[model samples]
Target chain A: MWARTEEILPYALLLPSLVFLALLILIPMVQALLLAIQADSGEFTTAYLQRMAVDVNFNDAWRNTLLLIVLIVPLQIVLALAMALLVNSRFKGHQWFLYVYAIPLAISDLAAGILWLAVFTERGYLNTAAQGLGIVDQAKVYLSFENFGGLVAAIVIAESWRATAIVMVILVAGLQLIPRDFFEAADLFGANRLRRTLYVVLPLLRPSLQSALIIRTIFAFQTFAVVLALAGRNMPVIAAEAYSWYANNRDAHLAASYALLLLGLTIVFTFVYLRVLGLREAEVKR
Target chain B: MAGIRMQGIVKTFGKTTAIKEISLEVKDGEFLVLLGPSGCGKTTLLRCIAGLETVDAGRIFIGDRDVTDLPPRHRNIAMVFQSYAVFPHMTVRSNIGFGLRMKRVPKPQLERRVQEGAALLALEPFLDRYPAQLSGGQRQRVAVARALVMDAPVLLMDEPLSNLDALLRLQARADLKRLHREVKRTTVYVTHDQVEAMSMGDRIAVMREGVIEQCEPPMQLYTNPASQFVGGFIGSPPMNFLRGRTKAGAFEGEGFSLPMDGSRVEDGRELLLGIRAEQIRFGERGVPARVQVVEPLGATALVTVLVGKVPVKVDAPVNTTVRPDQNVSLAFEPADIRWMDATTGAALAH
Candidate 1:
């Protein structure tokens, strides 16, 4: 009597997409778990689990991935904040600037990698610009660092350019959603630019920034294309390790183990992120 | 408290004119309300004074200093927005202390002033709570406390109480009046509600289409609205108007006639006739009307009477029962009539 059968129609209509999502994401995830448990011996062994930590190459790949997250997370947040703030302001051709910032997001990672490679070439635009600006008479082969810094820089540039749009997009949305009256109230209080940004903008932006962080961190962990293009055959990213196990070693069991490691990393970080967000929500609730 | 003066304030947004050469003065320590329907440019005018919105052509003087071009932060004024606009992240103490902190008042002084503002707002228990953790009224009070912390001479509020529930709104209104008395800051409030404007303001400026139609004390606006629009807008149950011609021949009309007042001008010409619903009386000496509807609202009853071809609503004391579709008659002394220019809708000055 509370609600008629007609009211349930809209909910009933949602079952297909729900089922599709279950098949696409949930089923595969469940299959990975089953495959994790079932070996030829039909006994659950700790062999695959031990491989994730004990295998030197997998360990190094994960270590590098974590390193990438540590370096890129803060950098991406800062850059995105700057971009969102700049776009939030009034200027000539502001919309055009926003559209320009957003364009990298639409390009495929393969395309972006190829495009960035042109700048890295000896006779590329960087060399030409250096000659034109007279900073350097000729282009130097500068990108080949012995360590992973150059690779990190390349990934940063490519990933920053690609993923920054989404952060800027979210922060810009948050910026717009803040009532103009709040700023005016701050203004009335004689809050200077930095004070206002730190106290008001940052605090109001926590939930939004937290959400962006989780998404971007997961994205950073899944950083395959840019890492692959920049890091090349020698560097050991998790995805690169999986590819090596499958195509090179032709070991499906090993490849599945590497894939499962990637999944585990994602789940752990996601759990931590969700737990932090829940705490924040609880504090707000209190 | 400082008086605010504006000379020839004009604000145009591209081709659309928002405020067209508005000029007014707020007396020191006075509560002046800009009362108008939405988009009448009342908010824009308030913003121009608060230094939030710029005026295309104007000179604003706060206590005789030209503040028209100064940035809002430089202007010694505070504002409370309709949304409460409290910073969601800060505890109530920090939110209240934000202004003092901006000026880099020594930390002790900052703490003391924050405490003072909190005490004034009765926000002691909620000092550690964030804006998001508070009720709507609490948030609004925090916003007010934040405004108070500045200790500015003028407080500009744009529909500040509009977001509160009805009972809370009433309480907030009383608190605002009390706060103004204690703080003694010249306040300029903007609202469309006549009740709010009437009750809270020392003087009310009734605006229409970006122009001040009339500015007067509350009783004057009620007893003597400068125009028919002001009359209609500033009253509940509204002033009733009828289109008719005033002629020497018994004030002739299609379904109604009246014994014409001898002193009436524009005779034999079409003009609008307005009467307050409260002024109409029910009796046998008047014109017979069909009782169309009766709406009882506790203490008062509003009766819709069909007189000839025109329907008039009259407010009467409750317990006077009359069924719809019954016969009724209404009469009133002719002196209560208000006349307006039919074309321009401006009241004809008596």
Candidate 2:
């Protein structure tokens, strides 16, 4: 019944979602910023930020988080790329392989942590298998607090297995968007499989790769319940420490600062991904 | 340049046979156009020779090498796709040099060849640009340049100009002919356009339902089509067919009678009378027909006429004053009439 000029229509239609975003997302972010920087007397202060700096758990959590990202993202990208290529090959029953590969996506992060713990903990499936295979003389406590490297390895394996599916799905969609003729042309030009993947598929899949990297990196930064479920008190990641600060220490200020720091790191990494792999608007049009 | 030879090539996809037992040869340094409609196995046959499609049963030879079982990389043949298939991410120079780069050709030679190809296609100005920045015609030229730089003895093109606008198609067609003349590679080009086949091909192979009906030079194929299908498929304002019966030494239709040789014809037997539009002319004494529609095409006009219920088309000069609905006598020489078996649609011996 009402008509509006073309210039005004899009903004008018976007007004409702903008209002919702301002209320739900912006307000919370502002409140967290306030809580993180303000002292108990409600005065602007850096006391909580300094306290967070001095916290023992903060240093360990920061190091563990960085190490986890360093280990997990590349592992996931490589595994996801391999899985995506395997599915793209249209091997026998590839549709079934897609379903099988996506099974991890249905498993929650906490569930995946517990699932792998059953294999990696002392007297767990991995230990029993190693013992049965005569690779290990006896059952060993692989996830102990003292065995920091082994615990990190266990967490890396679990996180990669659980989250690689998301990246794989993104890569598969990107692979499908590339026209078949490009590969055929490459073949006609005497490119073998490795050369085709390196030259044709990878370069064409830049945008998808950028998105997958940014999303996975942010999700890695926010990783919480998985660390808590697998390591309990033995490992303290930023997210897990933020949880402990709020629940155990009853210090929401420190918790908010930790959360803000995680968000900042996510933004920094996302910026890097965009800078390195982003397709120019003109390039995307091609 | 090397000739291409296929021996009883057969290819099937699922339950549908795309190319059925075809054996064809493109002579060395010859321009051979495979002319056929869509789904007529022309593209599949070309792909088979390029090693893109594996044959179920056949042997393909490029020059002296048997390349039937080799991968496309080993076949040493370049193909220009109908879609142009230019790498959108790469510059025109990189695209043109891609085959050479894959072979690890020294950078100097690759650059020289790429430059030569770009100059040949008049793409030197766009050599640094990506395919997306170029127009459709330019993109197709880049594809052609990419193929040319391969310097392979055999080249395959699948309706490469089909994606261009009408005016661009005309120019691209001329460019392709000039390139063929300069390179003299054994080219197997496929198109559904008869005009392209007629103008560009040194020899044209007309295919239908996966089999080649006739393979000959343009004028020979036009003057003597091997079957009713070839006769109907190869011309504009297509060859007209009138259902009738042969009586004694004359062919009789519903409202007309014409004299013909009856040595192989049975008396009072059903037959089809085929005549080209250009062969018929208006005359004072001939079969009487009323004009229906006239389409003036530059130098000539195609006139449609009705002889009782059967429609007939005659090519006339544009200046001729033949108006619609006017009764006129159309004349054709006895030798111009092609007789076909009414039931089988195969050409009947004269």
Candidate 3:
């Protein structure tokens, strides 16, 4: 009896979910901003901003996060690409392999970091196995704080194992979407395997690559749990700095300042990613 | 360009055979089309010749070499797929030039070949554009251009025009015919459309269930189809089949009797009598019938008539006095009769 559009009354239905998001997501974000700028001094000065500029600890945190992004994202992309290509082939038990590779996607970063700890600790699996095999005469002194490269390596491996599956899944979908007709046509045209991959597969897969890279960059920029779990307080990341500024020193003002800096960095990185991908070129209409 | 010849080629997928012990030879510079209905393995046979699919048994020769196990690249056979497999990332220039690039042809030679292929397909204006930017017809031309630049001995197509709209299909067909005329390359084309098979092929192979029923010139395929399947599959408003019994020298059906050719008859045996819709005239001594439907095609009318219980169609001039439910005497001349074994469905000689 009533018009369908008029009968449903959509605003009432959408009101509850919007209210929940506003409380849970938006409010906390606003609180973090307020706390970052709160200036622990009685008078609001530029002290928190000065801490970001002159503090060696804050600079170390900045350097470490960038170093991880530089080292981790490209490695994840390459590993994921290789996995996707190997899994894409007509191999038996591909389904089981896919599940095995994808299992880390659901595992938390904290869990993965702890799992790697079992390998890297001084009396851990690596040294124990090396001693058992007679490769080492004594227990190897591993997990030393002085080893910066080891710390970076631990964090890189943790991030790669946990995050590479996303890129693989994206590439796998891209691979499937390529019509088999193209490969047959390429073969008829005398294209070898390498030629086909370059001339046929890579070109068609550009969009998938673009999206996968963007997502991985976003995830890498925010990497926290794995660094903390593996390297502990000795390793300084952006998020760990923010937590220490707020909780340990009881300086919410400096924490929010650090949070704002990380936010700015994230936005800048996203814009750069979007530009690098040339996202609009591949989508030109037929 | 070399002539393609296949001798006793056989291929099977799992337990089912897609192409049986078949043999065909395409002459140098001939446009040959393979025609059949869906699941008839015309495409499968084309792939076998292209070296994209390997035959389970038998040899394939391109001019003088046995190339049964050769990879498609080594065979140098180019194919236009029903879906044009244009590379999505590359510009039209690179896509057409890809075959040359793979051969490690000289830079100048590659550019010259790409230029020539682009000009042939009228793809010069869009050379900088990727396949995603081209129209369907343009993509098809690029696909053909991709094949052409190879300069391979054989150009094989697997229902390349099936994806186009009816109007584009007609244009593409005419273009294909013209292209073949100019190049005079030995080509193997496959389609289910009989008109395409008829208009394009110098020799047509009519197939059914993985076996070629008949291989001959298009006119022979239309006029003297070697099997009941070929007869039924070829013509547009296809051949009309009627069940009849031979007694003495006469063939008796439901509504009327036709005098049998003694050479065609097995005495006192039941058989199928086939007549093309165009073969039987309207105003002749055929069979008495009532007009059930008259479909007015441009210059001719397909008149569907019911004689006793059997439905029959006759092609007559557009201005025939046939109306639904009207009675008329339709005639069948002895010359129009093709006798077939009703049980086996094989054509019997008259």
Candidate 4:
């Protein structure tokens, strides 16, 4: 009796969270799949998914979402690695710099979008500064409706600035796990700084880089508020399209289809990241 | 092979001075050991020579080049850290060949040098294994191989065997000495273990409070330490010190007296008598004391004797039947005694 209770005790304690997860996530995921694949009459059909595939905004949303991910993820990783290395150097007042760099993490995605919008919007800070410096005779419309590149650039900058801190934090944790002696050994062996970082530091940081890539890419797939705030209808992303289908058109089935597509993309990218940065047990242990 | 020369090297960490105007010469192909206690700046000095730590005020010369301003890479030196520092991501072969790879050595030569280093350290079978797959001793061998394959003129080791088990350390010590003899690289090793210094160092520099107290051959350091600190640091059980005053051509302390040799001494001047445990014997007709403790080793027993409240240790044969509370007389040879000035702790010249 005692052995049975001991074996069942952990699961008994976890029952509430398991139930909560089923209700909040698993059940909704099943519902979404059903809604995506079935009609209101409770018969299996491909009508809603086909409608999502042929929607007017579907192609633009797919292209914009992929472009954003491709542009933002790599840019954030490089910036985060540089920031992590700078913070890890432990120079004087580095704590202040770390705190400042992490300030973006405390901001909401929409707030970050609005923050950058203030700089790029017409008569905003950039134009004001350019005009004050006599670099431009008139205020430039950097985020105008016809300027698709400007809108995409604004969204990329905002998203990279806001989300790079998360990658930086993970990388900093990884950098700390490496012994200082490895770097000293590299220096004594006559490796230049760049080569040392490329050969020694990067290989050791694979696990962290893998995690950062997966997390940022998944978050990038779900990006909505930032783009909605910065580009409005000028750019369409997968999440924005899902929201438009559900809230504006009152079509939950099409929204569910878009959400399923986003999920599929996230899984594929995560799998690719895991396979590319796979580590042996020996490398992981130390 | 090249000698290392440092002229008036000084390093300070904020308000605390770590190395204070230290200058030393390491001869070509010399295996010099910097032996000191923790925080003695021995490791710091070794790093300064390696160009890992820049001296605040000094000029460093590797062979004949003034390398004071050069980074470690440009200095053409190799270092084996105490942690072994084998790259976890790379195999032992890659680690051994990493320096050559950095220098872009030809593939054939790189492979040959890596093989030679692996063979020297008996790491041939473990070449394809990552550092995490190997034992601590094997990893240490990989670190040494990595340094040796560099074929750099100067090699710096910061207590490389310190992380190994005691039994492995003994084995590694002998292997390192033999390797050093074979390679003939100018190596500067930092360690706090006196046994390692005595067995491996061609010359040992005893450091204290950021300065070298004495730099000499192992036996010379044992026999003739420049100061009381060096004498106390270099020996097991250390040198026994008895405080006394000189009067009537004899030095008399709490419960002991020894005749002063040819050295001129003022009447009633304060001094300390330094003698090793082995130099003092329990025999007939000398200073009498009560045996407080008897610690037995396989070959010998250390008997602690108290003479008028001052405890002095004497080495006795292991089979001796000495028990606690028994009284014994300790005999000291005049030639074995070192007289030190009590105030400055400097060895008095005879």
Candidate 5:
């Protein structure tokens, strides 16, 4: 009887989570698929998907989404790697630096967007500082629709600032896992600071970097609140368009179609990241 | 091809002084081992010599060149870490060749040197495999191979065998000693294992509380320890220390009195007597003791006897019949006993 209970215990313990997945995720996903591929009469149709394809914001939203990911992911990786290396150095006041750097990780995305909006506004501190520094004659609008580059730059800066902390924290944990003896051995082998980072630290940080890239890339595809708060209708992302379709146009089917496209892109890129940066099981264990 | 000389080396971490003014010299091509318990500043002193730790006050010379202000990369040295810091991502061949590659030794020369190191360490078959695919011993060999490939004049090893199991440790220890002899470089090895120090080092420096208690050849250190700490630390099962006061020409303890060297200590003065476990002989005429435990170790047996409140061990042949709670008599030659200061724990000579 004890052996029988043991055999069934795993399945019994997994039952609640399975039920929750089916109710909350699997069912909703299937419903969204149906809504994307069927009409109101419950007959199969491509009308909603076609409408999504020809939507005015579709191309721009995806283009902007790809641009954000291409620009922000690499920038965040570099910044986070630098931050992690600095914190691991145990410089004076390193504990305070760690706490200060991770403060943004606790900040909500919407709150961060609102906070940056306050900074990049026409009379915000940035322009005020520019004016004070005599780089500009007066406080000028930087987040205006006419200045597309400026708007994208502001969004990139805001997102990079708000999210690099998390990547840095992950990399810091990975760095700590590596034995200090490795660095000392490298030094004894006559590796300079640059060589040590390139040959030892970076190669060893693959697992953490890969995870950070995948997570940040997926989040980049779904950028909405930050975009909406900063650029509103002036700049569009795939998630923002999905929201616009559901809330403004009252078309849940079209919204689900957009959401499916975003999901497809995220899945594709996640696979790319896994294929490019993934380590074998043995490598990670080692 | 060079020796190391450190004069008045000191290192401190914040308020805690890790290494108190240490002066040591390692002759060229000699294998010198720093043997001590954990946190005794052995590793710190080695790191200072490696240029990995900055000395608070001292001068370090590697073959007449002062390296006290230089960084580790400029020290012209190689080191093997206890964790076997072989790069997990690189093949054994690449790991061994890394230092050469950094020095920009042309590819052909680099490959030849790496091959030589691999052959020396018996790692030929595992060259193409990454460190993850190798066993613990093989990984440690890869670390050694990396250090050897550099062809540096000096090598530093920090407890490199403490991670291995007993059998592997013995095997690795023998390999390290053989390799040191073959290379004939000035080597500084740090470990807490006295057996490794005794078997491998040309000279062993026994340390305690950030100071060297005694530095001498292994046999000399074993025979003539400068302090009670070295005597206690350098021997297996440790040296038995009996605390008592000198009365007439004998040292008196709780339940026994042993004849002492007449001029060794002054009468009516407190003193301590140190004797090796193996030095004591079991016979019918000697100090009285009651056997408490007997441990059989292959060819030999260790018998623990209670003399008053003190426990003394006597090594006997395995064939001897000794059991727990048996009455026994133990004795040692007067020349075998070491007299030490009771208050200071320093060895005293007549």
Candidate 6:
């Protein structure tokens, strides 16, 4: 009897979480999948998916979302790597620098968007500084409705600034795991600073880089608040279209379809990142 | 193929000084070992020579070049770390050729040199294996091969074999000595194990605190240590010390007395008599003591005898019969006794 209880104990303890997942996550996911393919009369149809495919904003939303991911992910990785290396160097005041670099992680995505918007607004800090320096005669409209490039740049900068701290934290943890002797060996072998970073540090930091890329890309697929705050309706993203379809147009079916597409893109990118950055069996064991 | 010289090197970390104004010369093509206990600054001195640590007020020279201001890479020196810091993601071949690649050596020449290094270390079979796939000893060989392929003028090793098991350490030690003889690179090795120092060093610098107590050939260090610390550090079952004062042309302690040259010291000066365990023997006439313990080994036994209240150890033949509580006399030649000042721990002139 005791042996049976021991065997069943783990599942018994896990029952609450399993039921919670069923009600909150798994059930919603199944309902969303069904709602995306079902009509109000309870008959199967391709009408909602076809409508989502031909929506006026669909192409623009897909294009903008992909462009943001491409521009923002790599930029954030580079910036985070620099920050992690700087903090890892353990300079006189490196602890302070670490806390300062991580400050953005405490901010919300919408708040970060508004923060950058304050700088790029017509009469904000950038224009004020340019005007005060006599570099420009007037305040430039950097986020004007017609300036698609300006809007995209603004959104990219905001998103990168807001999300880079998490990547830096992960990279810093990875950096600390490497022994100091490796760097010393590289130094003694005549590796310059750049060569050491490129060959030694980067190759050893593969696991961390893989994780940071996957996490940032997945979150990037669901990016909505930052773009909504910065570009408003000027730029359309997949997440923003899903929200609009459900809340404004009262079309839950189309919203579910958009969510399914977002999920598919996340899975594809995650798989690609895994395939590219995966460690071999030997590397993982160490 | 180059000698290292440091002049008046001093290094301090915050309130503590790690290396105090010490200078030494290493001969070209010499195997110099820095031996000391932990925190004794031997590794720090080696780092200064390798350009890994900057000396506060000293100039370092590799061969004839003033390399104090040069980075380690510019100094043309290679070092094997204690951790055997082989790149885990790379195969042994790439690791061995990394330095050559950095120098942009021609492909054929780089491959040839890598092959030569692997052959020297018996790593030809493991060339394509990652460090994680190899054993501890194999990874250590990879580290050595990587440094050797650099063909640097100077080689620095910081306890490179200390992590291996005892049997492997012995084998690796012999292998390293043979490799050194063949390459003859000006090498500086740092370790705390006296056995490693004695067996491998052409010359040993014994350090204490932050200063070198004595720097001499291994046999010289064994037979004639300059200070009490060096004598105590360089031997297995270290040198025995007995505190006493000179009285009536004899050295007298708590439980024993031995005749000495009176003219060499004052009649009442306090001193310490140092003797090795192997140097003392059982005899019919000498200091008398009671046996305390007998530890038997294969060919020899360590007999602990109490002279007065102080226990003294003597290496004896294993077949000899002696038990605890038995009485015995310890004898030694007068010339073998080392006299040291009790307070300062410095050897006193005979």
**Best candidate according to TM-score:** 2
lDDT at A7 for candidate 5?
100
Expressed as tens digits, the lDDT of each residue in A37-125 for candidate 1 is 55767777667656655766877788888888888888889999988888887588888889999999999886786677677656767
Q: Return whichever of 2 and 3 wins on TM-score.
A: 2
- For candidate 4, the per-residue lDDT at B76 reads 83
Q: Candidate 6's residue-wise lDDT over B1-350, tens digit each? A: 78999899999888899998889999999999999999999999988888888888889999999999999889989889899889988888999999999888999999999999999999999888788888899989999999998999899999999999999999999999999999999999999999999999999999888898999999988877788899999988788888899999999988788889878798989998888999998899888889999999778999888888877888999987878999888899988988999889899876
State the lDDT at B170 in candidate 3.
99
DockQ-derived CAPRI band for the predicted complex in model 2: medium
lDDT for model 4, please.
Answer: 0.91
User: How much is B320 displaced in model 6, in angstroms?
Assistant: 1.1
lDDT of each: 0.82, 0.90, 0.85, 0.91, 0.90, 0.91
lDDT of 4 by residue, A1-286 (tens): 9999999999999999999999999999999989888899999999988998999999999999999999999999999999999999899998898889999999999898888889998978999999999999998898867999999888889998899999999999999988888888888887888999999999988999999999999999999999998888789899999999999999999999999899889999999999889887766464
lDDT computed for candidate 3: 0.85
Error of 3 at A269 (Å): 2.3
Cα error of candidate 6 at position B299, Å: 1.6
Candidate 6 stretches with Cα past 4 Å from truth are A1-23, A40-46
RMSD (Cα, Å) of model 1: 3.8
Q: lDDT of model 6 at residue B311?
A: 78
Q: Provide the lDDT at B312 for model 1.
A: 80
Better of 3 and 5 by lDDT: 5
Model 5, position B19, has a per-residue lDDT of 89
How would you encode candidate 3's per-residue C-alpha lDDT over B140-201 as one tens digit per residue? 99999988888888899989899888999999999989999988889999999999999999
Worst 10 residues of 6 chain A by lDDT: A277-286
Which residue segments of model 5 deviate by more than 4 Å?
Answer: A1-24, A105-111, A121-125, A138-141, A281-286, B253-261, B290-298, B318-329
Instruction: Summarize candidate 4's per-residue lDDT along B62-120 as a digit string, tens digits.
Output: 99999999999999899999888889999999999999999999999999999999999
* TM values, all candidates: 0.86, 0.96, 0.94, 0.93, 0.91, 0.95
